[model samples]
Target chain A: MSSTREIDALIDMMAKLPGLGPRSARRAVLHLIRKRALLLTPLADLMQTVAVTARECLNCGNVGTSDICDICTSEKRANGELCVVEDVADLWAMERSGVFKGRYHVLGGTLSALDAIGPQELRIPRLIDRVSTENITEVILALNATIDGQTTAHYIADQLDGQVTLTSLAQGVPIGGELDYLDDGTITAAMRARKSL
Target chain B: MSSTREIDALIDMMAKLPGLGPRSARRAVLHLIRKRALLLTPLADLMQTVAVTARECLNCGNVGTSDICDICTSEKRANGELCVVEDVADLWAMERSGVFKGRYHVLGGTLSALDAIGPQELRIPRLIDRVSTENITEVILALNATIDGQTTAHYIADQLDGQVTLTSLAQGVPIGGELDYLDDGTITAAMRARKSL
Candidate 1:
């Protein structure tokens, strides 16, 4: 009975996860009980480890296990190209294709005037600084093809207008399509056919 | 140029995420740069905090910010019914419904003979022990309808036969459909009409 309280509490918390409900949480908990070592134990261990070591890359804003992410420390990718996105999910989507050979900048979201979001609230200044300090030659505005995304892109283009080459993914990204929804082939095609903004 | 190398390394790592590709990662990185403070800075902070604090409930296998998950420690939920599931995702799905006032047991996965998984490899023993020690009156098997899921259910049922009431969610879970994919209403319906094995 005492442990049952604990179990109920666990189920309640689990129900709050993005996709689960009380029923499925109940089923899932039972399943985990039946596969403790292979799934439960390892999952628990991984969760604990990730809880303690997960972090965002200090220099580039990517999630990782270190202060300065692995990308920010590598010596093989200094190609003067910087790609942009709106969320970590989008960043993960891009990484799955394995075609881009540059660094990343996660925007977290689009500029929403209704939400009162502005450039100062974003990483616009840091981008400008990185453009100069990182000696970035080409800045690809690979944001989603939404109105806000395009607006943000135009704003950035204006800021670094004369300092560096500015380009963006061409054609494949549909109108209002978030980068996370596009397939690898489409993303690759878009990158290859990037147009100067 | 040096930072480009770092960026490339980061993109490479991003590509390894579940849904991203190189092209998208590049684009995402660029976006993050333009929205550094509004999005990137806060995201990084959150990631760092979550990375350091997320762990799993040792007793019921749910992920949380403590050694003994919040659910496990809470005293208000011991309803004598134990619902089981296959994964943390499923557990979360159940919790989202706001119903089911009992505990949970996460099995991690179904028993797969092809994968050489056995009862010992799962939390089966622990589950049986909990049934007795916790005064569990009803043990609900909410496993997926997959072949392996059914097999695991049968195996667990055999172990706990006549020890307590054993039932399963009635019908709403589609054949081979993961609980993660089911909507909350369907999960609730299934739970409300759960049938004895």
Candidate 2:
């Protein structure tokens, strides 16, 4: 607030971002000012470009620069398997791991009765269409382990019960996770799904 | 990384911001993309404007759009007391509190022996020049409570020993601070400066 209206406005907007608060926004604005040429200008330009170009892929609901995302168009990724995620962020996390070569279907969100979000609200119809039209053999539910996520997964599984091979992400102890730090549910799940090691 | 190059680049830049990490950056970028018209476009435009117009005040070193900041040029703020701070952010912080009515001098940094920074490295010389020129009655040292900050304060105090009335901020337990949670040094300082209420 000590700075000009523009600077104050910038700080206010920056503070609205996911991880930034008032203090951090002030620091970021100061940093951007100090590194104007090296960071601020380029960041502005890129944000403008993204503002104009970024869009959701019509085919899979994933965000991209085109009507259909790169994953949908890439021939290598069309391997008769589809990974269903609740949000684009989850899809990006999967991509970062580079473990899945199959295409993705962003559900947008889970079915929530409290919010009145049903299967029709998300990309469920599009996913069902893609499964038959795209020759998908396996449908991997990569949704979160939350209650809503589980309910949504169950709904999707029931929809494609006999149509294709359906699976969900294994619920067990995470890699590099300590047993003592895990919650009771996670410990019980890990114990129930014990490996032959 | 599943997003376009432009999107990826934006996430990377956003991650470098003070409070945001990779996950939060991705979420911010996604949010920006979704609210392009309402938030992203305007934020980008404002950033560009700030990048072009923002500058440090010639006299007080506060960041503003003019040679001298609004605080420095305001006729109402010509109160003879000058507050000295380690950075522009500190000046902003003071302004946000709306407590001080006088002007400010940003030191840019503290005098550090390890960093080879001295009085000349900061705006100490300029501050000394401004004291007589501006007819300053009092100089308040509003630096941090770090070792380097105290060292810098002592250095400044010695430099302007007899020229003007010099004072530093009082050290004590903060308002609503829990005694049990407070460190020994703070408790001791609070005891020494105990007020009769």
Candidate 3:
């Protein structure tokens, strides 16, 4: 607030970010101003570039710079399997692990009756189309374990009943999880689905 | 990383900001991409403008769009009282509170022995000159409560001992702070400086 209107406006916009509040926004603005050449200028340039070029992948609903995403177009990716996630962020998370070599189907969001979001609101139709046209043999539901997420997974499974082999992510103790710290549902799931050691 | 190069780069730069980790930065970048028209474009434009216009006030060391800040040029503010802080952020914090109606002197940073930073590294010399030239009657040290902050305050106090009245912000329990969560030093200070009920 002591700075000019432009600086204050920058702080206000930065504060609206997911994890950044007013306090951290101020710190970030100060840091950006101090490291203008190394951070601010480049950040501004990239933001502008992304603002102009970024678009949703028409085939999978994933965000990218082209009409079709890299994963959808890459011939190296496993074509028989498709990983379905509720959001583009989840798809990115799976990619970061470098485990799943197959392409992804971004649902855009989970089904929510309260919010009036159904199969039509998301990319369910597109996902079904990709499965048949892209020769997908298996559909892996990588949705979160939330109630709405499970509801969405079930709905998708019903829609694709006999068309493909469907599976959801395992629900159990996380890696490096402490038994005492885990919730009751997690502990029960972990115990019920105990694997052979 | 599944996103485009520019988006991934933006997320990387955002992760470097204070209080934002890689996960949150990814979320923020996605949100910006989704709301490009409403948030991203304006933010980029404003950042570019601030990058070019923001500068240190010649007299006060405050970050502003002009050589001399608005506060420094304002005759309405109390001229006899000068508040000194370690950074422009602190000056902005004071301004947000809207408590002190006086000009400020930003020290840039504290006197850090480990970093070999002394009075010359900060705006201590400028402060001394301003005290005499500006006819300052009182100098309030609004530096942080850290060890280095106290050391810098002592150094400044010594320099202006006889010339002007010197004072520093009080240290103790903060407003709305619970006694159970307060540290030993804070409790001791509060008890020593206890006031009549």
Candidate 4:
């Protein structure tokens, strides 16, 4: 029996998910139907709410529902330190550890020559501005171990040399490992053992 | 520098995401702010569109934009075979392989006695009804290899014992390995080598 167009549309959208495809999308849609009240309804409601309210923080380049993010506004997080990361996923990883007490600066992406991405494409300039304005004394580069990540780190360091203490997460993260893959404990250890760049 | 209530509320919701926490949620919100036009605007628009249009297929339980799913409505897919799976993720995995020509049936979940989930909790009864009414000649179970998955499969088998040709994906899927984790080639091989139940 052929599925309806609406179901196909949902499957098509689900197939676009990071790890799902058409078949899995179909199954997921089905599961949601079977558990309409318990799972599907809630999921749909949350998705709708997020769709309307979700926005990016203007100051920190984070995804939220307002102009400024919570971290950027929290006085308790202004401990003279700032953590820098290539992606929001990295920032999330650090937060999951519940160790760091400082603010954050999301660079959006790394500098990749092949992809024609440079400092102008990332939020490097904005990061520099945050250091002085936020009274940050130390900046932690919690980037991935990929070549582009290191390149971005060095570039940022050059821009902020002699201005603030620049450091990076120490050895613990495997080579080429993305911060999103590392467990919370490993991220914490790396953050604690960070070395000056 | 406390964030506005709106920003805080957004962060709180983001924190509930599968892999995010309060800190990361805050950072993500900030990043979206910096790239409002390029990333945030488009993302927000897509989220809103999906929220308004997304629904489930009335016949096959697939998520979509209308009452019936595309696959269920497509005349070309009216093959006599129906492949049953445990989740939407599983169905998408199968579709990604581009092998199976028949349609699908999403069971939503397994028959778990511990969780007090029974056949009624799933779409088993609807599946049986569809089999006879849709002129289905074969039913292929492509559930995971977990204990609960097997139990669910057995129950389904008993439900349609002599009504149609009952079969299952071959024993190629690793133990406890979800179909979503398997590659397209593996899914295709398993489907091609399905065995009689």
Candidate 5:
């Protein structure tokens, strides 16, 4: 709706965000303009700063301001148990829960045969290198339950077999998940993985 | 999940946007960082430019990069008709349809007795000034179909009664709107304002 090119460009770029569309982008831009000093300027400055400093960690593939992410650099995070995730968002999810104490390795993507993606394309070689060099005692595959995720996990498990303790996240019902709403595969997985009381 | 304060602050600010939550903000920031050269830099630059240039038009409430918006300044648009809207967003919506060739006067908000919003609080005084001074022959009250919107329309109509041709948007079923899904008020309005075949 904006006649100005700069405003239109801003809206276009905002529409490219993961959740926002063109309508929402227009609303967001107008809101930012109304609160320019409070929101627009600060957001622009922050984006500029992030653009200048943000980089992928060479060791762990996690994103941070430095070359090596804090998780890879921190001594306390090296708890001998490494968690391998398919994406940076998944790594962030794991961190938000405060469940994992070990370092993380972000694969960036899964091993997809259809897409011609191999282990080398998704930081699997780096994961193997970390396992051997970082004194990691165990490796947890925290990949999603999708077909590609499971395939990548299996490949990683096979590659690191007998080298370290290899494990995959237990498949089961999600928190607050209803059996009536769950798919057959999830129900079956939850049944097979039933633990002893 | 970012260890650096800069990235975390960026995520926080992004979360403050209208449609984004913390998770979405993190995802958007990550996406921006991943596509820094293509999207992030341009968005930041555009936002900065908009922040410096964008302002409310002095003649109308529409947002533009100049003192007077393009519609308000265009001689072709000054066809003795003024479309009044409750917000700049509504003005932009009307402009997108390309139906109304006349200029707009954004009220910024509607008359709200519950919120103690009076004529002076909104752009009602400015609308009154424009109607008398700008040789406007017809004024369209294109307010929303809400109680406040109708109330504001009545107040403006009362103020400009007998001064010029006053009209409001026709109430009826929207384009491709199904009767089964239509609300009672909408059906009533459509029935009362039915057009003869």
Candidate 6:
């Protein structure tokens, strides 16, 4: 081993993270060791705190430090609109735009029949309950443009057919996107959704 | 914030690592949270332990969880052959090869004139002390092939002129390298050091 047992173990765990490999993990571990007081200790303390306190909100399935997330409990976010997403990451991307003033419903994953995943496998049941009881006016299906995502969105739209208004994000050439580099499906969608000048 | 304060802080700290950015940091933190019991808690505990115990070897500059590293304390490694490297990471790489069963001397960094760093800025003085006292017969300059590395090696060779035999790593094609991809400098060095086939 290039390092001690404890250090090696730490590097191994870091390597298992999403973007880091063995070499980068070793560099990161060395950096953390050099800046022990500044980075390593505080990161360790923060990880421990998050581990003990972080949980998924019961209402919207969003991750937070309590049973109900801040967005779910805040009155300003009770704008009668609930945006449905495939994961917390999608919900976070939506929140980063700062254009949405309503709460979110995290589905955790889409309904995948090949994987034996159904509505109950995800948080779809809880989403249905929230739409019926929360006095929601509209449900936005801001899912990815994947087959599974569209299938899940269609299923949710069917379930809430007469309960409230159903909508989805518009598909078009993204801002700063070039038509030459776009895929055929995207180009076709943009052509069909063309608007007046 | 998409998540709680603690989670966001953790993500921010993770982003400061060498290979991770904000998006990847968020993904890593979310992974850590999902596997809190199996990964997060243990990693946090290990970081804490390493932060408290890790230190630089007094004799050499190798990092370990002690005042003097295991290599410095091992009697069988006293083979009168000292390998000098530029950093603790280099020392670890040397050890990983499982060759060179002697000892090591880490210089912390090379002497850089532009940075106003001299022999005293590195561990050159300590290396000289070890050559006189450690009964070393050969000193291998395992420095890098960079300009500063060569300059430091030449300086060290001059410092220990007649005391011990001096040598350096060979410059040529790497083990799995191809001729088409080899640089002109490396090809010239390989030609100069051509072996009798």
Tens-digit per-residue lDDT, A130-150, candidate 2: 898999999999999999999
- Candidate 5 CAPRI category: high
For model 2, the stretches where C-alpha displacement exceeds 4 angstroms are: none
Chain B TM-score per candidate, please: 0.81, 0.96, 0.96, 0.82, 0.97, 0.96
Candidate 3 vs candidate 4: which has greater lDDT? 3
RMSD to native, candidate 3: 1.2
Model 1, range A33-126, lDDT digits (tens) per residue?
4444544444344333443455666677776667886676776667888887766556666766667788777665677789998877777777
Global lDDT of each candidate: 0.69, 0.92, 0.92, 0.74, 0.91, 0.93
> Whose lDDT is greatest here?
6
| Candidate 6 lDDT over residue span A94-169, tens digit each | 9999999999999999999999999999999999899989989999999999999999999999999999999999
Tens digit per residue, CA lDDT, model 3, B48-166? 99889988899999888999999999998756999999999899989989999989999999999999999999999999999999989999999998899999999999999999999
| Candidate 5 Cα lDDT to native | 0.91
Q: Model 5, B1-197: lDDT tens per residue? A: 55688899999999988998998999999899999999999999999999999999999989989999899889999899999999887988898899999999999998998999999999999999999999999999999999999999999999999999999999999999999999999999999999899
Tens-digit lDDT track for model 3 on A91-160? 9989989999899999999999999998999999988888888888999999999999999999999999
The complex in candidate 2 yields a DockQ of 0.84
- Report fnat for all candidates as fractions from 0 to 1: 0.00, 0.78, 0.80, 0.08, 0.81, 0.77
Please report how far candidate 6 places residue A34 from its true position, in Å: 0.7
What clash pairs does model 3 have? Answer: none
Sort all candidates by DockQ, best to worst.
2, 3, 5, 6, 4, 1
| lDDT of model 1 at position B154 | 97
What's the lDDT for residue A78 in model 6? 95
Model 6 chain B: worst 10 consecutive residues (lDDT sum): B87-96
Q: What is the DockQ of each candidate?
A: 0.07, 0.84, 0.83, 0.15, 0.81, 0.76
- Interface root-mean-square deviation, each candidate: 10.4, 0.9, 0.9, 6.7, 1.0, 0.9
Candidate 4 global TM-score: 0.58
Q: What lDDT tens digits, residue by residue, belong to model 5 across residues A1-197?
A: 55787888888889999999998898899899999999999999999998999999999888888998888888998889999999998998899899889999899999888999988788988888888898999999999999999988899999999999988888989999999999999999999999999
Off by over 4 Å in 3: none
**Cα distance off (Å), candidate 2, residue A41:** 0.7
